[model samples]
Target: MFTSMTVINILLSLVFLYFLGKYLLNMYFEGINRPEQWAGKLKQGKITRELQKAQRQYGDKSRFFLFWLQIERIKKEQIQGTFAELGVYKGDSARILHLMEPTRKIHLFDTFEGFIVADLAKEKGEAASYTPTNFSDTSVDEVKRFLGNSDTFVFYKGHFPESAQSLDTEKYAFVNIDVDLYNPTKAGLEYFYPRLSPGGVIIIHDYSYKWEGLVKAVDEFVRGIPENLVLSPDTDGSVLIIKNSVHT
Candidate 1:
């Protein structure tokens, strides 16, 4: 409707105004409020520091940040049941759970070696292709050493879901799945979900990066049990599912 020069000038002015507003908004947010500073610290340094502190204070052999957090939450809620961990690589997480909730019985499941062909197959879509031949470098022994003669904890050696099925426990307040494969994750869920006490918590490790299978399994599991289950924001690929009520 206007002359070409006028239109061009208006457009340039609008762009300038937009940039100016953006700059002012950014500056305002960056200054006294320092919201971005808090966010930056949370994203860059704080989370890592917290996780590291948890690991160090809890003992590196059997402690991971996500698992420890789950234990704290479970105990705070006063949930009633035993605790179990499937796919205990070196038993660090299980050991931490044992220490955190000393009154509760803790079950540790693992092959004590590295991944089996079946584990690799389910995780990587290729059986035996990615199996680790040497477990000498792994952390299983460290977990054992850390727990050294704990009476409240029991270790079950073998493939999971099967080992879990052998567990006679009728109820569990917490279950941690860290097998890193789809089948084990699925199997663990199937085995433990029914045993979970009302208001219990289930934690799946490696649910994010490097373990898409865990995420998929968790997603599908949550879909099937949407009423009482809630997933946590991803933590070291761990996904937490809290059962707020009984499924009936």
Candidate 2:
């Protein structure tokens, strides 16, 4: 018995609320994410293109902002080594990280074909229901095209650990692991932690309970490492590991 006008009004109200909520969230996040150096960076126009993109396009500003702050800290501390990402689903985060520091080389590892069957088999929680096809929509060529200029970028188009075999003693300043399951996340930690430079960083995405397998992997890995995890207030719950300046 609702009139057409009433329906239209309800829809309009919902649309207004949606935008209002988003605006409120962005404002709140900006306050906390803005560091003491933020004003200086803005006044000096020192903000990276990636940070701007995160602020304008990404829904999880909390997570992206935290990444920006961490990268700043790393640079300030004079951390040495290249950057890397284990799950380059579509080169989004990789692009962000690269643009943040275009001078450093960033290694991108992915199947370019989605989750591996072997890896997917061990998933639990939200990722448990995913199949090989879950994230298979992307390709290395596509990612490269999106990121533009291949300079300072390296693509390892295959399963990780194996894909990263070419990596030997090279140190890493920052590594991002967003594989969304247990095995590869664990593998990434195993391969990168030892190679991570002292005071380097590794960020693991999906560390919340929704990805039980990811949680399990991180929990087990952290127990064996000297650094503790610093959780992020992002959309998917990211966790960080900043390597000790001197540790085994």
Strongest candidate by lDDT? 2
Which window of 10 residues has the lowest lDDT sum in candidate 2?
48-57
* TM-score (all chains, Cα) for each model: 0.65, 0.86
Q: Across residues 112-206, which tens digit of lDDT does each residue of candidate 1 receive? A: 87767656665643222455663525555577787777677777877776766666666989888877667778888888887888778787766
* lDDT of predicted model 1: 0.67
lDDT values, one for every candidate: 0.67, 0.87
- Cα error, candidate 1, residue 204 (Å): 0.7
Backbone clash numbers for all candidates listed: 4, 0
Model 2 over residues 1-33: C-alpha lDDT tens digits? 989999999999999999999888877767676
Residue-level error in angstroms, candidate 2, position 174 = 0.4
